[model samples]
Target: MTGGPRTEPIDARAVLGRCRDAVAPALRAAVARLDPASREQATYHLGWTELDGRPGAGGGKAVRPALALISAAAAGAPIAAGLPGAVAVELVHNFSLLHDDLMDGDTERRHRRTVWAQWGAAAAILTGDALLALAHEVLLEAGSPDAAEAARLLAATVRELIRGQAEDVAFEQRDDVTVSECLAMAAGKTGSLLATSAAVGSILAGGPAGLTAALHGYGAELGMAFQLVDDLLGIWGDPAVTGKPVLSDLRSRKMSLPVTYAVHHGGAAGRELARWLAAPGPAGEVTDEPQLRRIAALVEDGGGRDWAAAEARRRMALAEKALAGAELPDRPRAELVALGRYLVDREF
Candidate 1:
């Protein structure tokens, strides 16, 4: 799927499905704790129910929850032992998605109207708040020996995620954003949560500190690799596969990894890219396909594309290296490594 799996690939769908099936009931019960209105919106957001409130299709790839369950297995525990971590991470993921949709003015997601688009921004905000609170509740109420420490970790991760989102918003107004700064934002926004996902199950399983730490390292590096590929797709992916138009990130002038590299590092073409980006975009977003293609070409010509692709592979290697010292069973370890490779090479 991606560049190529470094190890024989596990079926991504099956792994995700195993985790999703294990976590779904508990996740539903947790969402049921919210007020009726919030619960309704949350259910819809999760894709468990349609807008009219009937049973609907399933949700996302469940990647964070899968990592949570798999980490438990790596720690020599039953996957069910990871339920709290799995449910908490899934709630947190949806919480971020709810808030992000509104903040980014996104109207559609997964081929449906977003929470804010269908129910108003206030409703979206409230629903997101409820989900974030419920994430903590799930961890605190899990009653495991490590519940306290896991909750604390989740708290820290949430703070970093919010800080990253804040930085992303702040970047829109400034032109001097450095590549390092953008990377820092990405670590907080994306890496922190994935790190928590990979480590929290080990915590719940009462695994050794060294094992937990190693898992966190793997997740953190993999998160960076995943984000780089996502940025590439935001610019060049087929809309049919990606479920978004090509150059989506470029049009919004998002300071993605590649764009930032191109802006600061590409000599002449980079300078030209800067000028084009600085020009007031049509309605604050470049809509013309011809112009969008030109901007994408400039990003490639300026070396952003090549640099991002290389960095993604580098990060994936780092992810595998992070597990080198841990004495995990061959299968679980190989699966983790393969997941990172899949993210790097997937077209969408």
Candidate 2:
């Protein structure tokens, strides 16, 4: 007998919502311990409150934490066992975001002014530091048997994240970015934390080492796919959906994967694009909107967009393969598959 269609759609929204609900209390409690100014900035950055501190509806998709929780459940542990890891991963993720926004000079996020833009750079930096410290504090206080190891893993991941950010900043000033270098930077910047997020749940639950390794691999692949999609969005996504200016990455001349691929692979078109990018201003900055648009079109004509999209699908497949290798319970395994699908398949 022939098998039917093997994959089914998952309710990503519901899964993320449930994970957010489960982890929100602990996250809030951690933030509540911050001093008043830091607390307000942190809470606003997390979408827990408006600029004035009233409750608001802005929040992220909760994908990283959901991966932690779902991975824990897949390991045959209670969902509560994953809570500390989930919250810790979310905190670390946001810590990076706050710093990244400042470093990238981004003024907006989630359709609102960024923490740095709204509360000033010092407040944003301090609040980010508070979040990072609090992640460790909360993990250590969880009293899990593996709490120490979890804390160590998160600390190492943070160091790797900083390295990635540093490389990204350095790449902006250079014109000789190889695709391999770009991928390595993406793995460091985006993949390391996600790998930790996936493995932490299993580690905290004291799951088998093999299972934890498998989940880490899965999460890394998923993270690569996620970043590739982000690169696509930076070029072509709707401002309303992405909550940023149109073609913001191009305008800033960010060396996103698609742009990198185009610059390397587009032949004559690539050369033309490079000339425009090299047309720096008095301060060595490229900020002309008309030129930015031309570079975007050149990237498209050179097949950067198609290559990045294809690469995203390839990474998603790798993630699915890694998930298949893990010995998860059927329900949670299916959910993980669904989550992987949702991550790469999103428009925003």
Candidate 3:
């Protein structure tokens, strides 16, 4: 938040870039296999191309794929052994993104128009579905001895993901949502896939069960930290940095972790916030800048902001703890710890 980027023991950006470079070729090839329309949409969504088919300079952190590759390395396998799983994980991540952008009615991402905004809801849905299907295809064709089990794991994770998304949507309409329920939803939506990402590669490489399970636990806790930071950014992150409008989560009256905690425990401020949330008429997007600022302030005053940050730190510690007791290769194990720190501390 202060310096441009944090670089100490490890340059996380450098590490992430390397992972992206390793994963990009196969990811591109898989995207190329989509039908023309879905291909265009997928490429655009992935920041590989512009809306009009030209090259673009936008892309995500590639954290999930990175986790998969590192998980393979941590298991003492060649990183190449993780390629198919990494590609599958990345595809699934984007599938969720396309659908999330559509469902959230977000008009932009990565400083560009969202798929649903540029294309259409139907296009977004179908393209997302194509990606989901392709993820399974990639895994099954991987030829790894553990491919079937990995695919099954992915399928189960997807179910948890949808369950989380459904809970997220349901929370917006109800004012009585609990903090524990919010944590559970965050786990389902974010933790499930991340756990898969961290351990699927180990599964692919036939790693021992103990290490694989440890990596999975690491990912799950890291996911919680990741989502908490994201929620904070949704309310307080610079639009220029986050590629989103200010207070985007509060705008939609989203019952994010911070807001839910504030409403559940903020005393007078929480009561005031609850009234605003439950006001008459559908809780639509709030665009007034001053009002948005006040709501963000109320969330802070109600302890949502501090609570979220503390919880993130707590989760990060737990994630790192999962690695400490495991018999993991030094390099990837350390990298995994670096990656988890970046997730909670990242500015974008």
Candidate 4:
């Protein structure tokens, strides 16, 4: 239970269970309308159907949609009003996953074939594009003011996302990356969309302006915390639980927090890591592993993981502070806090 909720945490599990239950059906119905042929293929890849087209596994954790609904209730908005917005966020989230798999040359996600692996890169790209379009279309049903705000958020978030991706790719070729720069890149790539989700959810819920502002602040902090945790998991988490190869981030020369720290704290190991990451190579391929593992060890020795965990905890505190300022009702607020805690503690 190390990466799960504590049983003595005052029914946090029960609260999150209720929120998850409420969100899942709406997410399913939203996905049910894709053209049968394409839908079947996507579903197959998602492990919702067998390779032979029989019923199969459950889909992803559905966290983004759940956040939207949970935030809506916390803001005193009708949960129904947030459904379209939730669906929009989910569509956008999945679209990012599809494209990310291709960019990282990953073969699998959620223990199933990635869109690129199952359908080829061109098909995956097209499918992701289609999802992006559908995400926008879904936002149109979010009501006038909500739709307009969500659309604005979507546009700005995409810009930041692309900028972050560019920075991430650029980090591979440069030895000058600082910890601050890496955090900025992380914010643009990972935090922007999450911040938008909370902000849009509040808008849809008809929350007071102050409450909506507080929710956006909460999401930004939580998003930062989430990515920091992800960086830690990428390097040190059990492969079976994380569903990815160990030290995969180092192998790919990605500029995550650990790598940034190692770069700053120059030494034999840091130099070795810098040397490997700066190796001139084709984009989007894993480089040397022996050297990468050595660097990962150095990172651990240098307290990079500890530093990152502390930072994540700090951000979590900030998020909670923002939530408190939002002044949500007790039941819904408790659920939201539980959900946030669960996100921070997730193993996969």
Candidate 5:
């Protein structure tokens, strides 16, 4: 779909960079309360310090915090008004990542060793717990007029995030995963936090209820689209750009969207895939390269990749619609729309 009129193109990278710059100081201060050991681990995980406590330059895309700040701006408040909520969502995101690395047995993230891999699972788990607690602490201490309400909202979102993650882990063992179930899991695991990021921003800004709801809807759709793209990348993304091994999801036997679709809707190819998945082997040992290539080809032949791409586009359209409906100024709304497009449009 064609976006709104534009004088110049919206630069999503620049916007995200600004958000990172604004939130980094607050994030560092919040995590500083931990003991030196925990602090070092946490900082390292955040891409601010090396494993040996030296400076480093690796980190996530900072998308959630940018969503928070932009949502606040859409609600007619200055971006700084959402700093507390931005920091809160970002901390929660990283906390989930730390634990996820342990749970998924993933060794690398953003081209660096995972916290669990670097310092042992115990250190990773404790530092993650510290970050989760610090997220709330930062919110409460932000002195926002609606801090109490924002905290309550964030608490509920955390519960949803846990529930989603639990479902994801459980799905790995079951063979009967459905597309609908996978969508629900995505909502819980990914959508909930994103929706909360937008909602918390609007709440902190004291934006109108309708506008808050619209932003929440925007975030939910964006989160689903984001996860769908991630699923696609897991199979076909360039290793150099994505910083993950090729066919990483298939190797791990994850029930991601494309795999689920292929398994359920791919007819003969689908059955072959099921058989391969059921083949007994050592845990976490993916099929060899030749077999893995066959699996990837089977998935593509089954229409799984095309289906997921279509769904991503559909969700992104809904996200843009939600942003357009919000009672935001023209420029911020356009930027938000541009951000939604960029999210689903990325290759890595």
Candidate 6:
């Protein structure tokens, strides 16, 4: 894929950075209030924060909280009222990341060693559990009018997220990854959290049914687009920026969008790729780097990268279009539109 011109002159990093600073203090306060015992510990050795309470290595772009705030604003909701909800979603997202790194045995995230890699899997799992509990406490204290309803969404979202993770792990063990199956997996893996966020924000705002539905639709499309773009980058992204090896998805035998498309589009090459995937005991443990490179060539030649990017762009357009019918004030409309565009089009 070529490095191309951006559609707009928006600095997503700048926007995300501001949002993080705004939310981080609230989030830390909420966490500290939940379990003072944990807060009192001298050094927990958590991956993203230093013992001195400074940013350790790096956190993330903090997109989940941004989505919560943007959706709330779009529905004409108060930003302060939605603050706890935003913080809750961000905490849950990080919890997922902590565990996901363990599941994938991923070493590097945000250009630093993952929690599981640095402190061991037990510590990582415990940290993830602690964050999940803190998320619930924060949401409950935030106390929206529809707090009960939002709590229900939070519970259901967690269940669905776990189910989605299971589906992804299972997919790695099989060779028959259909396009429809892959879409369903992506929906559960990425869609549930974003959809819940939008829905919770609208519910808190007392939005009309139509507005709520539109926000949900917008978030669903955004998540689909986000995952597809991630898959594309898994094969073609700059390693320096992404902090992951180029073509690492292919090398690891992961069932990503490009490989799934190749299986359906590349005939013999696709079949060979599928065979290699089935031959694996686990992904990324193989002794042969040259063979893996050959598989990446097959996926590239099969037009999988192009197909995934096109699909991502299509979903992003749909996300943008969904907002056309949403009830939003001017400030929100501008920011949310920009946010949606950047989600689908971001480099890092």
Return model 4's CA RMSD, one decimal: 4.2
Clashing pairs in 6: none
Give lDDT tens digits, candidate 4, residues 242-293: 8778777766767789778776774666676667667786766565677657
lDDT string for model 1 (64-86, tens) is: 99899889888999888789999
- What lDDT does the true structure give each of the candidates? 0.87, 0.86, 0.90, 0.74, 0.86, 0.74
Task: For candidate 3, give the lDDT of residue 42.
Answer: 91
Candidate 4 vs. true structure, TM-score: 0.87
lDDT of 6 by residue, 1-348 (tens): 112222455566676787777777787676676454344221233344664567566466777777777667767777665677788888788778879889988887766666677668877787788888888878877666677777778888888888888999999777888977888888888988887776667766667778777777878888889899888777777888677776677667788988898888878888777777777466346546677678878887777777888888898778767777666666656666677777778662
What value does the lDDT take at residue 149 in candidate 1? 96
Q: Locate the minimum summed-lDDT window of 10 residues in model 2.
A: 1-10
Q: What is the alpha-carbon RMSD of candidate 5 to the true structure?
A: 1.9
Displacement of the residue 12 alpha carbon in candidate 2, Å: 1.4
Across 129-160, the per-residue lDDT of candidate 2 in tens digits comes to 98999899988887889889989999999998
Task: Name model 5 segments beyond 4 Å from true.
Answer: 1-8
Question: lDDT (0-100) at residue 212 of candidate 4?
Answer: 77
Instruction: For model 6, give the 10-residue run with minimal summed lDDT.
Output: 37-46
Residue pairs whose backbone atoms clash in candidate 5: none
> Quick one: best lDDT, which candidate?
3
Model 1 vs. true fold: TM: 0.96
Per-residue lDDT tens digits for candidate 5, residues 1-348, read 135435457888888788889888888888888888779888888899887767899588888898888878878899888999999999999999999999988898888899899889998899889888888988888787888988998989989999999999999889899999999999999999988887788888888989889889989998999999999999999888788788888888788899899999999998888888777867766958788889988888888899999999999888878766667777667777777788889773
Q: What are the TM-scores, per candidate, against the unseen true structure?
A: 0.96, 0.94, 0.95, 0.87, 0.96, 0.88
